[model samples]
Target chain A: MSAPMDKPESSRRQFFNGTVRGAFLFLLGAATTLLFRRSQPKRTVWQIDPYKCICCTNCATKCVMHPSAVKCVQVYPMCGYCKLCTGYFEPEPISLDTGAENQLCPTGAIKRRQLEDPYYEYNIDEPLCIGCAKCVKGCVLFGNGSFFLQVRHDRCVNCDECAIAIACPSQAFQRVPADKPYLFKNREHQA
Target chain B: MRRMLRACLYLTLLSLPLVAAFGVERFPPPEFDAGYKMPVTTMPPARALWLSYVDVAVLVAALALASYLVLKKRSRDGVLALSVFSLLYFGFYQQGCVCSIGSVQDVALALFNSGYVVPLTTVAFFLLPLLFTLFFGRTFCSGVCPMGAMQDLVLLKPVKVPAWLEHALGTLPFVYLGAGILFAATGSLFIICEYDPFVALYRRTGSFGMLALGAAFLIVGIFVGRPYCRFLCPYGALLSLVSRFSKWGVTLSPTDCIHCQICDTACPYGAIADPMLKDPHPDPRKRARRRLALLALTALLVVLGGWLGERLSVPFSNSHATVSLAEQIAAEDAGKIKEPTDASKAFRQTGQPVEELYAEAHRVRGRFAVGSVLFGAFVGLVFGLTLISVSEPHERNVYDPDPADCVSCGRCYVYCPKEIVRVKRIQGKNVIPLTPVRGEQKG
Candidate 1:
C-alpha cells in the first residue's frame, strides 16, 4: 500500500538531497577546472628513444599488441654497406649467404643485397620484424649502428601505460607529442 | 696476423664509450655507380588527435542518452541498445585504451608527478562520468561504460550473492583503488590498467594470464551481473560515492509502489530496497548504545588497517623498478647471485654510481611508506563506514532503488505493475488491472 509520509519530512529530504547535490557539483567543478588547467593541451603517444635503447628484446614480448608496434629501422645514410654485414649475417656464418640459418634476424626481417663488389645493402622487412632487436644489437656492436627500433604508430594503440616501457631495461620508452610520434637516430654524430 | 688484428680491434671497440658508440659512424655509405636510389624509411602516422576528441564527444552523447533513457524514457530496450553500441565503439573499436577505468591512474599520476602532463582527453575521460553521476546517478554504468556493457551483455541466469559475502567482496574495489593510486602516484605502475580483465579481450591479444582473467570474469558474469563493476572497478567506487548524493535517480515504479516486491527480484544487482514494515529497533536508548559501540569498532578497524599497511611498506616498495633493481645489484655485489639481470646490466652500463641508485630506491621506498599508510587508512575508513551504514536504520517507505548500488539499467521498470499500467495507458490500450488493488485485497 502507498504509505502517506508527512509533507515536511518529504520536503526536508528533498532539501537535503538538493544541498548535497549542489555541494557535489561544486566539488566536481573545482576538480575538473584544476585538472584541466594542469593537463597538457597536446596529446601524446608512446615512442622509443633510440639512443637509450639497450636492445634487450623486451619490446618483442612485453607489448600488449601481439607482434608489438616496435620494428627495426635502418638508417641508409650511415650504413657501411660491408660485404660481411654484421646486422644481416650471424656473428660466425658458414658463408655470407641469404640462408635462414645464417640470418641474424630470427624472423629473417633483414634482407641483404649486393650493391657492388665489396658493398652490401641491408633492408628491414617491417612486416616480418618482431622487434627482438637482434640485428640492432649486431649493428650497434660491429657495424655503423644504422639499425634501431621505433614504435610504429599505426600498429600502436597508444595505451596510457605502455607495457614495454615497464619491461624496458634501459628506460628508453617515452611519450612524444602525437604530432611527432617517431624518434629517429640523428646523423649529426655520424661523420 | 688477421685474427690478431681483429682481436685488437674488438678490444678497442669494447674499451670505447659503448653508450657514445650507439650512433657513431665508423664507416660511411659506399658511392654507387649504378645510380641506386635509397628507399626512405616510412614513418606511420599516429592516431589523429581529433579522433581522441571525437571519442570524448561520443562518450558525452552516450552518457546523456543513457541518462535520458534511464530516468526520463525509462526504456530498458533503449538502454540495452545503447549498451551494445557502447560495447562496440568503446570496447571493440577503440580497443579499451584511454577508458575511464584506466584514466584513474592518469589523473593520479598527473596530480602527484609535476613532470607528467595528462592529456586533455584523459582528464575529460576521468571526470565526465563522475560529474554525470553526481547529477544523474550512475547512468554511465547502466549503458555507457564498455566494461560494464561487456559484463551486462554476458549475464544470463543471474544468482543472488549472500548479503554478507557481497559486503565483504564489495570492499575489494576500494582496496584496489588505493593500491592503484599509491603505485601510480609513486610512478611505479598503473596497476588498474595492468590488471584490467576486459581490456585483453578488447585488444584480442595479451599475455595468457590476462586472457584467462578476462575469460574468467565473463564466465562468472553469466551468473553474477557486472562482477567487475560491482566488486573490482575502481572508477565504479568513485561513481558510487558521487551517486549516493545524486539529485535524481531511476525509480522502480513510474507512479507509485503497490508493495508487490516484484522489482526486488527483477534487479540482478539486488539494488532495490524493500519498504520497511516498521522500525527494527523501537527503543531509542538501545539504538544509541549500538551506534556508539559500532563507532568504537570502526575506529579500531581504521587503526589496525593503517598499522598493517605501514608494515607492508617494504614489500610494496619492491613493486617499484628502481627499488628492485637496487636490491638485485646489492645481491650481485654480495655474491648472492652470479648472473646480472638485463636491468642490472643496463644500469651498470650507464656508469651511474651504485650509491646513487640505492639513494633513489631509498627515496622511492620512503614515498611508498607514506603512501601505504594513507592507503590503509582510507580502506579502513571505507570498511568502517560500510559497517556503520549497514547497521543504521532506514526510513525508506517504498521499493526504492539504492542510489549507490543501482546501475540504472532499467531492468525493474517492466516488473512494476504500476509501470506496466502506465505503459499500456500511453499506448491507448483498454487498461485492465493486472493485480487486485492493495486496499481492495484486504477488504
Candidate 2:
C-alpha cells in the first residue's frame, strides 16, 4: 500500500507542474499585452527629407530594386516648360535630334515633344525616370525650378512611422497633415 | 478575475472617443502629430558607445544574478532576489517601450523591406535578447518584462488549468511567429508595433477597459501563472521554439525531486519542471506527430491571416502609396480640395488635401483592425495549444541552452531542480547577471 501511494503522489506532483507551466505562459502573454498598452502619444514611425539631395546620378545605381522607386519630378508651374530646354539635353545640340542616344536622359525618361515650331515641350516619363535628378540638377542650375525630386507618397508604404525621415541626408522632409499629407512648396527656395 | 479585467480593458478602449472629446481644439489634434519618435533614433557613435557600455554591463550582471538566484535552493534570500530581478526586468521593458522580440521583429522586417531600414538602435534592441539567452533561460519574459512584473505583483494565488487546454494553446505562438515574419516580410504590416497592449498599461492613460484588462491579468496571473507568455504573445511563441532546440539551458539536479509542488506553487511565473518522474527523453513519435500537426496548422493560419489583412487593407493601401503631389499638380494654376470635407477639422490645415486626410484616417483604422485580429488569433493559439500540450515535462536535465530564444528570462535557471549550480565566469569585465541580487530589497 505504501509503495503504490508513492507512485500516485509523484504523478500528482507532475500534474501540478504541468498545469502551472501552462498558466504561466497564458499570463505572460496577457501581461505583455497589457503592459505594452500603456499611454503613449502617437509615435510617428516614418519620415523622409528633400533638401540635401544633390541630384546625384546614383539613384539609378544605388537602388537594389528594379525601376528604382525613386523618380524625377517637375514643378510644372515653376517649369519654363522650355521649348529648347537645356535640362533635357546639351544646350547647343548640333542638330535637333530626339533619338535616344542624343537625348540628355540616359534612361530616355525625358520626352521632348514639339509644343510649337520654336517652343518645343519637355515632359518626364516617370516610369523610366530614375530620380538620378540629372535633369533636376540641370533645370535647377540653368532654368526655372521646373524639375525637382519629390517622393510619390502614393508609392510609399508609409509604415506606422516613417523610416526615410531618419535616413534622409537633407532635413527637407517635414510631417505634413496626415489628412492632407503633402505640403508642396511651389514657392522659390527661401534663404 | 480575468473576465473583469478584460471588460475593463475593452471598456477603456471603447472610451477613446470620450478622451478625444476632451481633446483641445487645436488644428492638428495632438494625437495626430505630437508623440515621441522611436528613441532608438538619433543614435550616433558617442551615444552608441555610452549606451553599449551601460547596456552590456547591466545586462550581463542581471543575467548572472537571475540564473544564480533561480537555481539556488528555495531560501528566503533566493526568493527575494528572484522577485526583484524579475520586476526590474519588467520595469526596463516598460521604459524601453518595446520588448526584445517586438524590437527584433521590427528591425528585421525593416531591413528586409527595400522601402526602408530601421535605425541602428533597433539593431541593438534585437540583439540584446540573444546574447543574454545564451547563458540564461528566457529572462525576458520572467525578469526583464514589465508585463511579467505586473503579473508577478498581482498574482495573489494561482489556478490550475486542464492539460487539454494547455496543449491546444501551446501552438499559437509559433503560428504568430510565422505569421508575423511573413506579413512583415511582405511589407503588408508591422504587426508587432500595432498591437502591444502593455504599452497602454505603463502609460496609465490607456482606455479603462485596457487598464481593467491589465488589472485583471495581474490578478489572474497569481492563480494561473505566466498566462500572458504562455498564451498570447507571438514573440513568446517564437522564443519557445528557439529555446526548445537550444544547446544549453536550465536543468534538473541528479537527485530525487521530493514530490513537492512547492516550486510549482511558489513560481509566480510558473516555469518549473519537476525533477522527479520526468522523462529524460520526450516520446519522439509524439513530438514528430505534433510537429507535423503544427506545420499544417501554421499554414492554415498564415494564409487566412494574409488574405484577411489584404481584404481589410484595400481602402487605405491605394491612397497611402507615395507619389509626388507637387509634380502631379505642376500644371494646376490653383489648388482645391481633391476630396471634400471641411478643412476646418482637426489637423486639416486650411489648404490640406481631403483625399490625404481621408487616407490617413483609413490607414489608422485599417491597421488597427488587422493588427487586432492577428494578435487576437495569436493569443488564442498560444493559450489553447499550451493547455492541450501540457504534460509531465520530461526529466531532461537542461532547458533550452542557446543564445537565441532564451531572452534570459531566468525562469528555467531559478526554478531549475538542479542541486549543482554553474558559477559563470567573466574576464576583464564585470558582467551583470540577468538575475537579481537576492539580498538587496528596494523600496
Candidate 3:
C-alpha cells in the first residue's frame, strides 16, 4: 500500500504478462475476424414521421427498387371526401366519374368509399399509394388538409446519413429525436 | 471464346472515338448564328461514353471476372462476395429510393413549372439502366443503388416477394418507364415528379402518407429484402431483361451447396431462386400461350402507354389545357410578380405562348391517376410473365453481374474469401477490399 510501484506480481512477470496480453489481443482479433466473416453491423431505423410532411408523393415515384420506398397507410377515421378533394383532384373536377381520367392520385390510391348516398369517404390503398401527393396538393389547395404525407420510419434507414433529406426541396424532412419520433397529425391540423 | 474476346476488344477500340467526340459536352452555338435554332435532339453526349467505352469496358470486365470467379468453384461465399459489393454500390451510393429514370418523368412533368427537360444527362440516365436491365437481372437493385441499398442495410431478415403479388406489382415499373418516356418524348408531361414520394416527403418535411408508404416498404423489405427490385422497380423490371442473359450472376456452387441453409441466412437478398424453380423453363403449349399473352399485353400497354403519355402531355403544353380558377389566379399573380425575366422571355421565344403553357394545370391531376393504372397494369403483366416462366434463379451461389444498377462499390470483394487469391487480369489484377463490420466483435 505504501509503495505505488511495488506489487505482488514481479516486474519480469508483469512484462511477460503484458506480452501474453498482447498475444491474446492478436488471437482475439484473428478469431473475431474468422467468426464474423460475413457479419455486418445492425442499425435501428424508423417507420416514419407524420409532422413536417407536405404531402408530396416522392415515396411512390422515387423509389429505385420499384413498387417504391413509399406505401400509403390509412388513418381511416380522418377521411372525408368533399366534392372538392384537394388530395384527390383539382378543386373543380370536370365530372365525378371516379375514373383515373378524373382523379388527382397517380396510382388510383385514393379509393372513394360511399359512407351514405351523398357523403363518400376517400381511402388510400396503402399498397398502391406512392405518396406523390398530387391528391394532397389538390386537397390542401382546394379542400380540407385531410390527407398528408409522412416519412415511414420503418422504411427509413435512420441513416447516420439520410439520402432523401439531402434532396428534399422543402427541407421538410428532419431527424426525429431518437427517443420518441412519430409526429402524428395535430388535432387542429386534422381539420 | 478467343474470337468473342477479340470482338469485345475491337468494340472497345472502335467505340473510343465516338465516346471522346460525343460524351456529354456543352458546345457553343454555331459562330455565325445568333439564332436560337438548336437541334431538337442532339446526340446525347453521355451516350457516347456509355454506349461506346464505359459499357464496353464494364461488359468486358464483368464477363472476365465472372469466368474467373466461376472457376473458383468454391463456396457459395463467392456469390455473396460479389452480391454484397454490388448491393452496396447500387443501393447506397445511388440513393435507391429515387429513380433516376423516374426523374426524367418528373422533369418531364415540371412543364407546369416551365422546366424544359434537362437533356443529355436525362436521356442517358434513363436509357443506360434500361439497356443494362435487358441482359442482367435487376442487379442495379441488388448492389448499385440506394433505395435497395437502404433496404439491404436495414433488413434484419429477408424473405421472397410473394408470387402473385410479386408478379402483379412487378409489371408496374415498366409501364411507368414506358409511359414516362413516351410522355417525355411527346413534350406533354412528366407525371414522375407529380407523384414523387421522396420530393413530397422532402417538401412537406414530415408526412403521414409518405411515412405510411415508407413504413410499409420497410416492413416488406424486412420480410423480403429488395422488395422494390423484385416486385416494383420499373427500372428493375427493365434491367431484369438485360440481366437475364448476363454472363455471370450470383449463382450457388451446386456441389458445395450441401443444402445447408447457412448461405440462405447469410445472403440478405432473397435472390437464391430455389433450384426447384430453376429447372429449365418448360412446356410448349403453356409457353406458347404465355408468348401470345405477352405479345397481347405488350401491344395493349404500348398503345395504352402512348395514349396516356399523350393525354398526360397535353396538360402542361396544350393551349386549350384546363386550369383551375385558383391556379389561374396564382399563375396570373406569379406572372405579374415575375416581371418576365430575360431568361423566361427567351424561353418563351424558343417555344409556345407562356399563358398557354400555364393553362394546363388542370390536366396534371388526371395524368397521375390514369398513368398509375396503366403503369400498374403493365407491371402486372411483366411480373405474371416472370412468375410463369421462372428459370435460372440464383441456383448457383455466386453473384451475378448487373450493369444497370452496378455502381461498382467493392464491399463484396472485401467480404469474399477467394478474393484473397488475387485473380489475374491482363490489364492488372483487381485487389479485393476487406469487408466493413459493425461494433463489438461477436467472437
TM-score of chain A of each: 0.88, 0.64, 0.62
Residue B21 of candidate 2: its Cα lDDT? 16
lDDT of each: 0.85, 0.46, 0.44
Candidate DockQ values, in order, are 0.52, 0.02, 0.01
Best by DockQ: 1
- All candidates: TM-score: 0.92, 0.45, 0.38
Candidate 1 C-alpha error for residue B372, in Å: 0.6
For each candidate, give the interface RMSD after superposing the true interface residues on Cα.
4.4, 21.7, 27.9
Give the poorly placed runs of model 3, Cα more than 4 Å off: A1-191, B1-101, B104-139, B182-208, B254-269, B276-443
**Ranking of all predicted structures according to TM-score, beginning with the best and ending with the worst:** 1, 2, 3
**TM-scores computed on chain B for all candidates:** 0.92, 0.54, 0.47
Q: What is the lDDT of residue B115 in candidate 3?
A: 32
TM-score-better candidate, 1 vs 2: 1
Native contacts retained, all candidates in order: 0.66, 0.00, 0.00
Docking class of 3: incorrect
lDDT of 1: 0.85
